[model samples]
Target: MSREEVKLPDLPVPTALDADEEAEKNLTTAPEVPVTPYTPSAVTPWSQDSGVATLTADTAPGTTVPVDDLPIAVGVPEGADPAAIDGDWKVDLAAPAASQDAGVSGMIMRVTPPADADPAAQVSIAVDTAGFADLYGTQAAARFGMVLLPNCVMDSPDSGDCAADGGTTTMSG
Candidate 1:
């Protein structure tokens, strides 16, 4: 069939209202609002601490004792990116190649991040026992119990204390 082209007619435009007439017709007196004077309440200053001895110590020369250094040590790479390392991390445990031990029976990993990080941020962790099956038997890996403890200063989870804030992942293989 042959098709014929159709032309559409132009739409009519709306007329604009007169500025004076529109303003006068829409004008109305607004209700009066009551104004209240602002009066601040009296505030009391915090009291200073009084001098009181809570504990008495009679010191001698040989009263102190020292302990040995910690076993675990964490060293960041010399040129590691700060931003790249700031996040949740997971570690897999497997027997060392050079070690004569049967497999990794137990291991502990400690991670310390830079100070000034947000404490409200969630601490996520995952212990991967899949790698242990290669070195150790699958039964041993399944029997192992994993524990993660995150410590913070003042025991406050909301305080972003990076010095005492670190998480430890331990597995008893």
Candidate 2:
């Protein structure tokens, strides 16, 4: 005896209204969101004491203070003409000459005094920019004491592969 094959009927296609209703049902009804008006507050300047600077702001959390508003002073020594110093300042970390082969193994910021300025002049560095967090991670800027920038290194000093002949040297962070 041969068995007969049973065929199933196809589902009916949804109409436009049905589709619209389905969409409407799936959509989330936006809750009544209350809007809050922003009110500006007074700006509190940063204060420094005993080489430690404290930044205080009245703005809401996650708000960044403007870079120009930071109270950072790079003190030039007395009788040193600020005009003689180079406007282009470069900051980096350097290891001692004995540790030059080790490259910058530590976090010490060395800022180059302006060219033509007094070599013995005192210089102060302050950083309060948004990029500060990105550049130094969570490290405090005050922890980095000033040091004379060292000559560039060709490669990782710890790598033990740096060329003896002074090849093109790049400053390691």
Go through the candidates in order and give each one's C-alpha lDDT. Answer: 0.33, 0.39
Model 2: which ten-residue window has the lowest total lDDT? 48-57
- Please give, for residues 1-173, the per-residue lDDT of candidate 1 as tens digits: 33465666898999997567545566578988999864323222111111111111221222211111222222222343333334322222222331223122444334333344344432322334443433344355457564443343113333453232324223552
Question: What lDDT is obtained when candidate 1 is compared to the true structure?
Answer: 0.33
- Candidate 2: segments with Cα more than 4 A from true spot: 1-110, 129-144, 147-149, 153-173
What TM-score would each prediction reach against the true structure? 0.24, 0.27
Tens digits of per-residue lDDT, candidate 2, 1-173, equal: 33566666898998764345445456577899999864323222223212222223222232222223333334433444444442444444332342434443233333444455556644445445333422333343435444443243322443333444434356671
Per-prediction backbone clash count: 0, 2
The lDDT, on a scale of 0 to 1, for candidate 2 is: 0.39
Candidate 1: where are CA atoms >4 Å away?
Answer: 1-104, 119-122, 134-136, 148-173
